[model samples]
Structures are given as structure tokens and as C-alpha cells.
Target: MYGFIWRHLPGNPWVKALISVVLVLAAVYVLFQYVFPWAEPLLPFNDVTVNDQ
Candidate 1:
């Protein structure tokens, strides 16, 4: 997958690297801004358990 992205990016090595970084940041931003918020309520990790003796 990474190799496919690297190949598809158009430019010299430096330009490709910059574009790759920008793309990664954009993906992360989208995940935090939309995907994670949408999925947060569906996750079960917020439930707490305790034992009393």
C-alpha cells in the first residue's frame, strides 16, 4: 500500500516526501475530526468494572 502511494505521488524525492507528510497529516486530521468522534460512542472501553469484598 505504501509502495503504491509512493509510486503514485508525482515529483522528485523531496517533493514526494513533503507530499507524503501532508497526506498523512490530512488523513490523521480527518480521523480525529470525523471518524473517531463518530466511532467513539460505539466503543465499549468506557465501561468500568470493580470487585468488592
Candidate 2:
């Protein structure tokens, strides 16, 4: 799969690197901006809050 993807991408190393980075950023943007915000409220995590009451 990695070989196929690399082969389809740009031949130049610099151009391939740029495309890889852009692809990653695009995925992250879609995940964090669209999915994570909605999923975070539904999923639970430990909240550590220190309060002097």
C-alpha cells in the first residue's frame, strides 16, 4: 500500500514531501474540526482539576 501510494505521488522527493504534509494536514483538519469536537462530548475522559474550596 505504501509503495503504491508513493509511486502515484510526485517523483521529486521535495514535491512528494509537500504533498504528504498537505494530505496529513487536510486529514487532521477534517478530524479535529469536524469529528473530534462532536465525539469528544460523547466520549469520556478523566478530568483532573485542582480547586481550593
Candidate 3:
């Protein structure tokens, strides 16, 4: 899959590397800014409890 993307990206190695970094950053930004926030409330990570036995 990654090989397919690398082949489709325009320009030589340097340009391709730059574009790859940018695409990764954009994906991370979207996940953190939108996806994670939307899914957070649905997850059980915050449902913590402690017993003093």
C-alpha cells in the first residue's frame, strides 16, 4: 500500500520524502483534532474507580 502511494507521489526522492512527511503530519493532525475527540466520549478509558478495602 505504501509502495503504491510512494509511486504515485510526484517528483524525485527529495520531493517525495517531503510530501510523505507532510501527508503523515496532516493525517496525525486530523486524527488528534477531530477523530480522537469524537471517539473519546465513547471509550471507557475515563470510567475509572477505586475501592478502599
Over 4 Å off in model 3, which ranges? none
What pairs collide in candidate 1?
A: none
lDDT of 2 by residue, 1-53 (tens): 86787789976988988898898999999999999989897875756587999
Measured against the true structure, the TM-scores of the candidates, in listed sequence, are 0.90, 0.67, 0.90
The CA lDDT at 20 in model 1 is 94
**For model 1, what is the C-alpha lDDT against the true structure?**
0.96
lDDT of 3 at 47: 88
Candidate 3 local lDDT, 3-31, one digit each (tens): 99999999999999999999999999999
Go through the candidates in order and give each one's C-alpha lDDT: 0.96, 0.86, 0.99
Clashing residue pairs in all predictions, respectively, total 0, 0, 0
lDDT of 3 at 38: 100
Error of 3 at 34 (Å): 0.5
Model 1 per-residue lDDT tens digits across residues 1-53: 99999999999999999999999999999999999999999998889888896
For candidate 2, give the lDDT of residue 26: 100
Q: Rank the candidates by lDDT, best first.
A: 3, 1, 2
Which stretches of model 2 miss by more than 4 angstroms? 46-53
- Candidate 3 all-Cα RMSD: 0.9
